[model samples]
Target: MNTHPLRWDALVFGVLFALVLVGWALLTYDLASVDGLAVAGLVTLIVAGLAGIALTLRRTS
Candidate 1:
């Protein structure tokens, strides 16, 4: 039988994604405006994407 090695990148990505969701929820609840939600969601997604990209680059390098 063959098995694959454990990966930390997947774990990190999941954690970061979850954090983005939590942050967006909190921001939506606190701000309660379409504009606010849009801004918050955009920022949260950008930060998460950057983290994921950095992790991928690190692994490749």
Candidate 2:
């Protein structure tokens, strides 16, 4: 059985994943450029995105 808190956590994780994906895709698609602070932002997004996913999946296991 899952609680509301867990469900919310999962949702947040999903959103973060999507955000990171979009950021990367934007760079790849040439729709945006990531330089300087933008580079840092992407790195943060990638790490945070992976961590969020790991936490969400861990909760399921």
Candidate 3:
């Protein structure tokens, strides 16, 4: 029986989604420039990739 309630994977994914939503809102409201949003998106992708790799490794080990 599993006793833990908190799901780390879901939490990480939710955080990433929230970041995308925030960036989109900023762009839509003209609070951020397109270039800035692009950079932020790139950074987010990198972070997500790293997180995925780490999670995979953790699961395997």
Candidate 3 lDDT, 1-22, residue by residue in tens: 8798999889988987898899
User: What is candidate 2's lDDT per residue for 10-59, written digit by digit as tens?
Assistant: 88779878877987888888888777438767788799789979999999
Better of 1 and 3 by lDDT: 3
Off by over 4 Å in 1: 1-31
lDDT of 2 at 24: 84
Between prediction 2 and prediction 3, the one with superior TM-score is 3
Q: Tell me the TM-score of model 3.
A: 0.60
Cα lDDT listed for each candidate: 0.78, 0.79, 0.89
Over 1-61, each residue of candidate 1 has an lDDT whose tens digit, in order, gives 9998979899878877886677677766784565766786799779978997999999999
Task: Order the numbered candidates by lDDT, best leading.
Answer: 3, 2, 1
Model 3 residue 42 lDDT score: 95
For every candidate in turn, the CA RMSD to the true structure comes to 5.2, 7.5, 3.6
Candidate 3 lowest-lDDT run of ten = 12-21
Each model's TM-score? Answer: 0.51, 0.47, 0.60
Provide the lDDT at 20 for model 2. 77
